[model samples]
Target: MTSRVLTCLLLSVLCALPALGARPVPAPAADGMAMLQRVDTARVQGSPSTLRTELDAQQAKAPKDPMPRVYRAFLALPSDESFAEFKALAVVYPENPWPHVGMGLVYVRWGMLKDAAAPLETARKAVPGFAPALWADGLRLQAEGKPAEAEARLREALTKLDIPRFRTDLALLLAGRPGAAAEARALLVRSVKDWPEQPEALQVLSRLAREAGDAKAGAEAGALLVALQPHDREAHRRQADAWLAAGDKAQAVKMLERYATLGGAEPAVLSTWVKLAVELDRPEDEAKALVRLAAATPKDPEPLLRLATLAEAKQDVAATEARLDQAAALAPERADIQVRRARLLLKLERYFESMAAYRAALAAPERPVPEAAEEAAQLTRKLHLPASPAKGTVEQIYDRVSLGLVALYLEHLMEKPELKGNLKVRVDLDPTGKATNVVVLYDSLQDVLITHSAHVAFMDAQYPPGSEPQVYQYVFRPPPR
Candidate 1:
């Protein structure tokens, strides 16, 4: 038999096992049917050898009954020998509906839709309203491109027996038909309600709910599916997506975290987690996701860059620099990384190093930052100031003081242009290159605001470290427009 036939036969045997006992047999064979039900129930709890022994005993007890023989043939199914056994039983039990149903089911499983029709019709004729025959005929008709007839047969079979398989099969058929979604959803809801362990029904319901834009329902179904199959990574991912769609980001993060724990290391998965974490203001979770994303995609510098930003926000300067270094190594031609490093160094008051970083960014082969050239020039001028303790003579320390005043005036004092003045200020430098105090003695403009502002601005200045305190006097004037 073809692989398709084998697969169909396997599914038919497995899915139909429980329904076999529930299917109505003739009144005269009620006792034999009860025994068949017992055998079917025992099949789950007993070993194969034990089941065979019980089947043999049942056959001896009801020698005239063909159900036990049918089950025996079923045990060796999808084989030529099993087909021969079923065919022999059909000939011996010509009046019985079961043997004909068995032959029809075999033909259906084998993909012989045309051959399956005659035997299923024969079984239906022998036992009017036989659900099994109707169900098999429905399948055959569906395969033969006769959906209307197939639907009719399945509906009739459901009338006889409202089992999970019948409901799900009919739901699946209706699910494919346009304008039948409501009915299909209703059937699937009832099927899953009646049989909570039905994974197939839940799977279809989840998909239909998602397609219908009912994210809440989809998430609920996905949650149940995850509970049923906790190890299924796709189920967790689907649940995560559904929860995210439903606007429950916390729950979505939980599901995605579970997926990751289950070895779901996809960059997309990690990226989504990172995004939600950021939106939810969960910095720790964001860091964790970025870490995993960085590890998962070694060549991608984005995660590292993001990590650097996060570290900088948390005031973790060392960690921020480390992440920036790693990202720069990965993307040497990216000017943005160099800009970030320069900014961080500036924050740390490392002007020379910051200037070098800005220059590097300006010279980057790719994505060079044109504005960084101006930033580098500003830092270079500050570094070369004659009064700068690192590069200037002690006499030119007053020039450094003048530079500080000019910068402070442009940044804050310029807001009050009327306050422009020439002031004499005394600045005392400590051994640590820090300005310990500033005393403004005279203001030519005679403005108290300018003198007080000059004192505050000089106090913030830095100079070369001296062995002892050294006081310097400088005269500052507003820059000429």
Candidate 2:
């Protein structure tokens, strides 16, 4: 018999067990049998209210039969009413295995495995090898996390009655155990091949294949699942992930775009799509995903940070600065942001400002990289800033001996007959009068080497203590041509 016909027969076994008494009720008439099939179809389709209405009609048509009442008990909620209905049927048809089967399934539906055991065992003893009893017991064991026992019962039920759900059940039970993925995949593959419309089998097969490192199998199974449930967003995502695992990035991007178009574009998914776009050399696509992600999670700094990195790669300094500023504003305490801002400022040729930014980055509560501290020290030396200051007066700080020291350092870097021009140097001093920074404020001859030498000499020199930063100007002219 076909699986559908067999499924109907199994459901009927749960409803139509033999009644007890000297004169038992006759079997359902052809019309009543058709009505029972309609109720079974409704139950399978998950239309519980329709199933209830059909069962009522079936009961009215065959008033003496207990099957309609038993089926009604399956759909009853609050379960108390269902339990009462089952008990009433058992009382009237004391020898029927179905009433007990109904009670067992009711407890199973309510997730009360312990309470379901006695009734299920009684039903098994009432009619040996009853398919519904075995099926319910198998599921109850599986729910209780006894997969070995559940597997045994489910396999036994399938041997007697090859139900497709039973195969899926056994496959699921096996899949949960380590080292059983291949076995589970084999079962599901056979089941799907036989019942091509089994969505659950296809889904399980996809997961098992993905976990087994068989990307081709996973992608094929996932493709079938998405086709079967076209509007299921998660199905599309799973297929996308499967394609990615298979190293089919183009297909992965296509599937994920479809997911986004269907409104399944969460921040995490969009983030993945962004990475894929970058790998595929598609900057515009990457930016699109980043924009979506930033909008989706307005408070998250990560997406903005990634956008800043992309901007820097394209040499778009202003865009980089703008994005980094936004990210820093969102998470001011983030040391990474501070470090990026410092680096960006240096690239813009704002040396002094960049130095301050670098210093702030180094001192943030979350420690910047040690390399950043090293880079800041390098900037300090290059800018002719004092590494440290010693307290004292102008003479105490820069005596004739100090002036000679500065002149000596400059003579070493000058031309044989030094260029004849007035090189005016301005040194910014700290509160202690030590020159913290020195710049070639005025270079009359515009001699690059002279200006550099003078700045170096000033960086090496020190001045008297002062309450605030003091500027010192010095005029130098070549002695001879």
Candidate 3:
């Protein structure tokens, strides 16, 4: 079956609240009230198992009350047990439409549509205008693949029922038919507005909105569904799908994060979450998912490897190295691991150690990285302190000039602990290492002293003799620890 059909089936199971009557059936006594309260509470907590014992106790206490028996038939869960109770109640209370209504619902829920007919008809005959009987018959027709007939019954039920469940079920039925989207959407919009706390209604509405390409409507329904189903991992994941379909990637990530946090760490979901977080530039969310992925796949090195990249972005050298060490330990022969270690070591200026890592990467049984050889040779020259590349060449010229920029930043910007900002200087270096044009592309600092120092620091600074204008951007924060 398709996932959408499966989700609809699951939803239908919960929407089995039998429409009893037009008016509320008052409990005969206080204990009956307590039983109803507990049942409602248990349903809210998603703990139906708790209902059986409590209902049994209530049934035993009030053998005369038909309401407990009505609830039992609904919550009993065991198809046979629920059927027997509802059947017995139907006979015991032949005059009451509720028992017959409950029996019909039990039969419909258990897929015994054939057997549901007699009790549903009996209930309608007993109470001439009871909406629950019509709704029950609608479910039977729906199960029997008679959607047109089912919709008719449900619509009739709605004339008397006017409840969220009736409207949502009718909407579900209509949504499955082609060209019925507008009518279905209208019903759901009204359903949610009238019954704001009904998650099932909102869930259906959200999916309808998503299918219609109404992203704002979908997101609104998705947000409410998530709030309503905080403990439902699969519900959260499904909501994530709806949000994603609606083009709300950030909200989708939020729902996915909730799914993972609630123990829905399936590999596919985790992988998608990682990709979304990276696309959204949410490092913190990406890290959270990576940690969960690592826990889920203890022997895999990918999560830790990706985490090392995030650590490098934050400039946490120790943390980056620690992550790399862990990844390398897990997959020592993996060529990519060696390559990453080489890159980190080179960034930290440990040339000799980086050379070893790069060589190891090159020698791995896996094909060597394309740039490994050139990078290794470059490191060799750095270690030997070879003559600088000819002036006007770009060979490491940026690196050489960056040292001066860093020094200027430390003096003019870092000196003020309370001040923090960034500056971008597009330096046009003509031949002879003279800067002909120094344009301040951006300076958040607004400090002329720092701007002047940056321009002067690069001016007359020796570059490759004929280097083209190179734009260098720098951000100064409080001095690194």
TM-score against native, each model: 0.56, 0.48, 0.59
lDDT of 1 at 136: 78
For lDDT, the strongest prediction is: 3
Cα lDDT tens digits, model 3, 1-481, are 3455345434433433344544334233233323533554467668877777777797678555667666766665336555655556555557667667667777777777898899989988987867777887898899999998999999998897576667878998998789998899899898778656666677778878878888779878878877767988998898788778778889888888889889887988988889999999999999998988888888889899889989989999998998998987888777778888899887876654576688788887663578877887776544432233223444455555555445545565545766677789887866766767678899997655456544544553567666678887767676566
Local lDDT at 203 for model 2:
80
lDDT of each: 0.72, 0.70, 0.73
Off-target runs (Cα >4 Å) in candidate 1 are 1-102, 122-128, 196-200, 210-213, 225-239, 255-270, 295-298, 312-319, 342-359, 362-481
Clash totals in order? 0, 1, 5
lDDT by residue (tens digit), candidate 1, 1-481: 5565455445434433332333334433334333434443344334446767777898789655557767766555545655665666555555667667767767777888788888888888887877877887898898888999999999998888777667878998999899998889889988777655556678889888888989888788778778777787777888898898888999999888888878888999989999999999999999988998999999999999999989989999999999998998999888988998998887887554575577678878887777787776676555433232323445555555456545655554456665555566666777777877766556665543334434533444455677345444444455677
Q: How accurate locally is residue 74 in candidate 3, as Cα lDDT from 0 to 100?
A: 64
Ranking of all candidate structures by their lDDT, best first: 3, 1, 2
Q: Quick one: how many clashes does candidate 2 have?
A: 1
Candidate 1 root-mean-square deviation in Å? 13.3
Q: Tell me which residue pairs clash in candidate 3.
A: 391-464, 391-465, 392-464, 392-465, 392-466
Off by over 4 Å in 3: 1-44, 49-63, 110-114, 192-203, 223-234, 262-271, 292-305, 326-355, 358-481
Q: Which residues of candidate 2, in runs, are more than 4 Å off?
A: 1-69, 75-78, 109-111, 141-148, 192-203, 223-238, 258-268, 275-291, 297-481
